[model samples]
Target: MDMKFKRNFCIVAHIDHGKSTLSDRLIQKSNIIDERKMKNQILDNMDIERERGITIKSQAVTIPYHAKDGNDYELNFVDTPGHVDFSYEVSRAIASCEGALLLIDASQGVESQTVSNMYMALEQDLTIVPVINKIDLPSADIPAVREQITNELGLDDSQTQLVSAKTGEGVDGLLEAVVNYFPAPQGDVDAPAQALIFDCHYDPYRGVVVHVRVKNGRIKTGGIIRMMSSGIDYKVEQIGIFKIDYEPTGCLEAGDVGYIIAGIKTVSDVRVGDTITNADNPAAEPLAGFKEVKPVVYSSIYPMDSNDYEELKSSLEKLKLNDASLVYEKDNSIALGNGFRCGFLGLLHLEIIQERLERDYDQAIIFTAPSVRYRVHLTDGSETFVDNPAEYPQGRIQSAEEPYIKASIITPATYLGSLMELCKMKRGEQTNMTYLDEKRVELTYEMPLAEVLFDFYDKLKSFSRGYASFDYEVIGYRPTQLVKVDILLNSKPVDALSFLSFKDNATDRARKVCERLKDEISRQQFKVAIQGAIGGQIIARETVSAVRKDVLAKCYGGDITRKRKLLEKQKEGKKRMKMFGDVELPQSAFLAVLKDNEAD
Candidate 1:
């Protein structure tokens, strides 16, 4: 394969902007998949991705296309998820390519994710090809969308490709432009092996399979290789490229994308963003562009059944092979039992992982409310990062700093008032606002990461009538009035029900949490008091009344004296039981509190 004839690029857009549909069209144009076997979202291999109509994981494939230029070109397509949570995957995909195809909805114009991804592609120095999708829709305002792309994103209108990914219209021109516009991969084939491992997954029978883009050298089936990051050596078991399925190739050359099976037993052995070089003739230095993924949001994940603890642990380890953004530590809770405190890039990343555990690994799990990492300063003049609210130090906290983010939202002009007001409620400071045109607006704000973690995205959707798009990047930490609120049932505090909250909203949050618990917790023999407190100062409380039975129900036409005797006996029994017996709350009660909407 000639390096000059290879075109490697990724398709990036906001969620539901026709990314997967466009990928299917590309595959069909290349004749990679039979038309009969083809289906919607073929690139999304997971059931959840199809059901949700969103790409969860990034997929890479090699296709052979005969362009209008009368030359055969090998196109390596990396399809990425559109949600903000998977932006890390988008970054990795951009690093592997020399160009990108930026897609935008014809009716919706430029959204927040589209802007975010376009800038990322620019940061990677990739040549971008702007494309307008869903042009066939009745609501598609092609003229307005083209103006948006040109004005807001600063792209030439003539350079944008218009297409309907669902109907396969105007895709031919898009293909020709890809091969003619994007530069081919440039690398020294004679140089020693230096490949960048962008993704990997664990195979139960064959070990860890790594997906890599050969940056500067060649790798063969029998050669010995070492991971530059870990310094672990292994004899390459197999080499292959994806063409609908893995087709073994004898060797992989520079500028080529493929996979390698290296008898790796666990994910810890191989790390994403790590470079691979020949063990015998290693390069002088590893390839550039390696950034470690740091999780921003964290929550406690535990097995619904204690016996599934090991299963959950093993499942997480296996899933971590491909998902390097997940971070976890052993955590124990008096209420939820043994669990792991897991960190994720964002909320969607957190949700996808938990779903995979239950659906793919068959392990029922429980999750606490998600929280952001907090920087804690002690009176002893030291700083620490706290991920769990239950572990926050009391009385020793000199000052608390919460993480902040630069958030961007794109919505219609009519929503400007409601959007800004909502941001203000989240403690957001206005940064800037740009009008894309007469109808669309882009608003930027500086807000706390904790404020956007929960209910913010939901509110954005509601305020804009499901037309707003949001993206956020963590800035630094700022001093804030923060407190750890705990929920108590029957005078005992549940660790899993504890959470960090803003002091101003503490009262409302506490009241809602107690109310949710009151509705979820069963009636006890004695009146159960549900209290929400911060350092022993009760802010909110609720009471669950005892379950009183009809002691005289069995009395049929019996004398009043007999009914009174029975009632007296029942009352005595209840008093004795209430004094000696313990109130045993069910697992659902704890789960209900953890899942409480206002807990955060």
Candidate 2:
């Protein structure tokens, strides 16, 4: 029996492109996982992913198959992050496998990101196994899709496979393709053990649960290991290999992937792309191609109450245990009091965490507008983080810079003109374009990451009528005119509403932001003034609707009905009002300015 070698693969698709449903069907048909309990994106492993139907992180599982040749084979599969913010982790996932299962919705066909992901797979020298998923849908066009994969992704007829990840159709053929087409690992078992830690998460008791791909080595429970990159050494407390059901695999050798539970317990202890090796004779260097993710979005997260400061800190620490990409530091927020300024890969990733904190932790969070990190050039010749516009010495700042990204999109040909208008509006510099098929086109542009984060997807959906998908990767940072936009409430600065913006858009952006705040904030028991000011000049102003019925006019001698209403009103007043001199400022006044909409 020639050792049957099957290529490990992962399904990569854009959000709403049906990656999870397809994976669910694949696992279900193998009888490796029960469908009744099978939730969408079971591999997501996070409550957030289940609710959103998006895979924010990558996951791995194994399903055995009986090949057409009547041979036994194991298909080790991984599911990866589709969003660019998680690209750092996604790159590692791509490296762990020999091929990818690129799922495309039959009706939507090839999306903007589908081509990008396929190209990344090619860069890794991984074989492309294109999948036309959701074929069972009423809208699915099977023939046109096969052409797009071959033309856009450069896949041959042999590489294209269509399947409905929903109905479990064509999945067996997809399994067969993986075994027949993809090449197995070419390695010597006797060579030095060198595995790569593609990704890891903090697992309280176990510390860091390092996800490793054995490039070369043998590992087992109780074996001592060292993170060759971090110089951190620990004895393997447990070795668990992934199946539909995880169990003690006893050991993992060269070309296999599994989790290593070492005594080392910290996120900082295991980094993506780091090499793991035997402790006694460690590999001297980490693998090349490890790129540290640069956070492009910044915002302040504060608790509604000043007393919740400690609670917020503990909450962030917990979030950081799993998300090492997040960076934060203690800071002051005038509106919400003490808080921390946090860095995120992008805005979507930032909003997701804030929502998770509120939903999962049941804590109300006061969030500031997202701002991209700015590079400032001082007259004295120095570079500094101009995060807080308040800290910026306007006259002294000679020049400023912000990060930029290379964005690409795939959509129906009908959306080409509409999306092009949007791209131009976002300062998107046209790079190139390719037609995926007669009905679909792939558009490429270079855009400022800041502009992309400020509701690029929302705009894309509206213009394209929800037919297009968006993706972007940071190309590099460049010098640009950046300014800080500040908000004032009754002439007093509200720190949480302040953010960074392009100088050209400042006045108009300020006006729009002020308008949004005015709309979201219901009028308090007192009139509140909202102003958008640049230095001494006020560009826009809006006032909260007056509280006409707040004054007690019909009460005499504390009449029973009036007295009851008065008592309840008094409690409510105390809950929301803060007094300074003769005037009372409603807590609602502070909250009214924290609107979700970004100003134009």
Candidate 3:
């Protein structure tokens, strides 16, 4: 293979600016992933990501691309998560690449976080390739967007590539940019075997499939490669690069992005950013890099069917194969019995993970509202975890400090007022504001991570009429007045669904959550009681009345299937309820919206 063809680059963009969709188009054009199997955003590789149209999980694909000069070279495509919760992961992702293809939606050019991410890439000294995507949109102003990228991102004219992911327009120019500009891998080929584990996953049969970029020398299959940081060694079983799926091949040489299979059954064996060296003669030092991922949100995840506890454990173990930052612990409660406490990078990260757990594992899970990590100080000078505010007793909290982020919002001037108002309501203080161009304002605010992760985002967008986009990075922890709001169904408290909010916002938030729960339960075939309270004060309550039509619609004698289905539906309804003799109230229920605007 020629030394010049390989360009390791990541695709970065603001949330909903078409990063994942653009990635799908790139995969289709490169023919790396089989078109039939290549679902939109194939690199997301997670069902939650697919449903949300966001890249919660990052993945890589190596494909061949052609230049305008009629030459071909392999381009390793690393798709990155767009949210700030996964920013640390994003940094590690870009470190493995030489450059990035920055996708900017033409109508919404150079968002706040877009600049921040591109700046991170700049700090890493990676080449910048600006791509103005969604140019096919009627509102697209390609020339203005290009100018914004040039001025704000500090990239050259040659660096900007325009493409419409939906229409497959100008994608060839993107490929050309990859080959012409992004430099090949730079490393010492003669040095003793050394590789950086960028990402990895555990396969029950094949062991751990670690995604590594060879920094020096060569690594062959069947050889013993020891992770220098942990001093753990594994026997290599397979070495390859993913071309749609994993394609096993020869030894991985320096500068090549590839995968290695080690006889390790767990994801914990191959940590990200670990240095890999041959067991015979290893490197003196480990790959001393990457900041640790600290989760800002904690949630309880338990099987809706309590019998699926073992299956839930297996499912989470499998999920952790590639997602190591996700922290889970078995939690037993007097109310919910047994469940797992899961930590996530942020609120979106928690939602995405929970969504994938249900979809991929085919198990229903009761996921609690996300809570921020809290710092508790005891009189005895011994500290303990109190992620859930409900765990803290009244007057017991000497001082409570919650995590906050410096959030940046980029939207049209029309949305400026609404966004600022939204920020203020969330206890955010404006830091700076800049105009990237006419009508486009970049407003920065210092707000609690907890504040933004709540319905603050939804309200912001709704107020701005869905034109506002937000990104937040953790600034530091700050002391504040917070309270735990618990939701009780009937007289019993639902331990898993409680939330913490500022004293001011607790009542309204509890009211809204309980009402939403009521509306959701009203559609179920059985009765449910929904209530929200703070301390002993009941703020809101609603009931999902029992289905009057639940009686047999038509009894067909001797029709075993219909009888069985009727019994199944009744049994299911029975299971969904907390039987109060005759009145039943479900812990939760799901309702699908119909065009008729009527309940099912």
Candidate 4:
């Protein structure tokens, strides 16, 4: 294929705004797959993605289109995830493209993530084509969406394409617009081979299959490729582009997007955002790779069985190969044994990773309560950041700070008051507010990241009746009154149950955990005391009553003294048992405490 006819673009939009559906339409229009086998979100291959109706990973496909101008073209576009947590995936997709299809729902108009993704595409200097999707809906407001494209996004309205991805209306015109509007990828095919490693996945048979976008020259089978970051070389076993599935092309030239399979066994050898070049004749310099992603939420992942520690470690390494944003390190706990401290973009990202591990890797795992990284200044004139409560500074006389995020929420005006009240309950401080129109409002707030980690998103959806769209970015840490709350079962501290909380909410949080533990812990021979404590001071406590024997029932209508004596003996036995008995903490108890604000 000629470089002039190769077009690289990505489909970007807010969550549920028809990015994946639009991709499906384009794929169908190109006849890439048989019509009998076609399905919704065809690019989303993961089970979790289809079940949840969300694209967790960015999927790329090559569409062979014959333009009306009688020129054959190869169009490569990435269908990106729209959630704020998966913004990193979108950025990676944008970096590999020369343009983007900024899809906006006609009914919903413009939302928060829609604007965020536009700015990201603009930052990369990619050409954007404004696409209005879902025009077939009864509530579709094409004029209002066009107005937003002009006024809100600052994009020219004349170039906008109105199409319903569901009904496949006006799709051919959009396909023509893609070839005519977007610029062709430019690179010198004669230059040394240099490809950017945007993504990769581990294969049991082929080892690591590296997904790359060739910036210059070409990559061929049997060529030795070197990772610019790690400087490790491997023999390229195969090279091909994705046509729904991998189709080996034997060689990938400049401006091409495809996968290169190298017989590399170790997962750490290949790094996302690293440049791949011919080892025999490498490029003079590596391409300016992607910016490092910093995770805001941190939690520990432990296996159900201690013997699965090694398997868990292997699974994480393999999972990291696919999800570059996942950050993790070896972690240990007294109660849970060996595990890994993992960092994720948000609660949703954390959940997806847990599910992928269980479903894809067949690993049963337990995740501790999520926590945001906190900055702690110790009394010894030292500064430390703590994401794990177990590593919190023991004596912290100096001030402490917790991570804060600037949240942007777009909702209907009808739910503004309740949404504002919800933010206030989360200890959010209003930063800005704007009315997008008479019906829609955008609210901005600065709030602690920890407060938003648990139920804030769920509450935002419920309060707005699923009309609100929320997006946030972590700002710098702010001064906060922080305290470490520990859970003790029968006087023994469970390190896995410890967490850091705002001082004002520490007592309430501790009481909630104690109560949850009480319900989860079953009755024992002796009373089991579950206590939430700060240092030596106990903030909250709940007692699980002891299971008693029917000594009195056996006595029947015996003498009163006999019954009294038996009762006294039972009391003495209980006292002795309480001194030596160890309360068995079930996995359910830990899980119960991890759940946030569930009904008792």
Model 2 ranges off by over 4 Å: 1-6, 34-36, 307-311, 361-363, 431-437, 477-479, 516-528, 544-592, 598-600
Best by TM-score: 4
TM-score versus the correct structure, for each prediction: 0.95, 0.86, 0.83, 0.98
**By lDDT: ranked, best first:** 4, 1, 3, 2
- RMSD (Å) of each candidate, 1 decimal: 2.5, 6.0, 8.7, 1.4
Clashes of each: 0, 2, 1, 0
lDDT-wise, the better of 1 and 3 is: 1
| Colliding pairs, model 2 | 112-409, 112-410
lDDT of 1 by residue, 1-600 (tens): 899999999999998899999999999888877789998889898998988999988999999988777888899989999999988889998989998999999988889899899999999999998999999999999988887788778877777999999899999999988998899999999999899989888888888989999999899999999999778899998998998788899799899998999787867888888899989999888888557788998998989889889989999999888688889989998877898999999877887897898898998888988888999999999989988987898899999999999999988999999999999999999999988777878899999998887789888999999998998888899998889998887667888888898899888888988988888877877678899999889999999888888887888986899999998998898778767767676778766766555224
Candidate 3, superposed: residue stretches over 4 Å from native: 2-5, 20-47, 66-72, 377-385, 486-494, 510-585, 589-600
Q: Candidates' lDDT values, in order?
A: 0.88, 0.75, 0.76, 0.92
Q: Candidates sorted by TM-score, descending order?
A: 4, 1, 2, 3
By TM-score, the better pick of 2 and 3 is: 2
Q: Per-residue lDDT tens digits of candidate 2, residues 308-339?
A: 88988877776775675778999885456888
Clashing pairs in 4: none
Candidate number with greatest lDDT: 4
Residue lDDT tens for model 4, 1-600: 999999999999999999989999999998989999999989999999999999999988998999999999999989999999999999999999999999999998899999999999999999999999999999999998898899888998989998999999989999899898999998999999999988888889989988899999999999999998888898999999999989999999999999999899999998889999999999999999889999999999999899999999999999999999999999999999999999999889998998999999999888898888999988889898999999988775598999999999999999999999999999999999999888989999999999998888888999999989999988899999999999998888999999899998999989999988888888999888889999999999999998999889887686899999999999999999999888878887777677654221
The TM-score, computed over Cα atoms with residue i paired to residue i, of candidate 4 is: 0.98
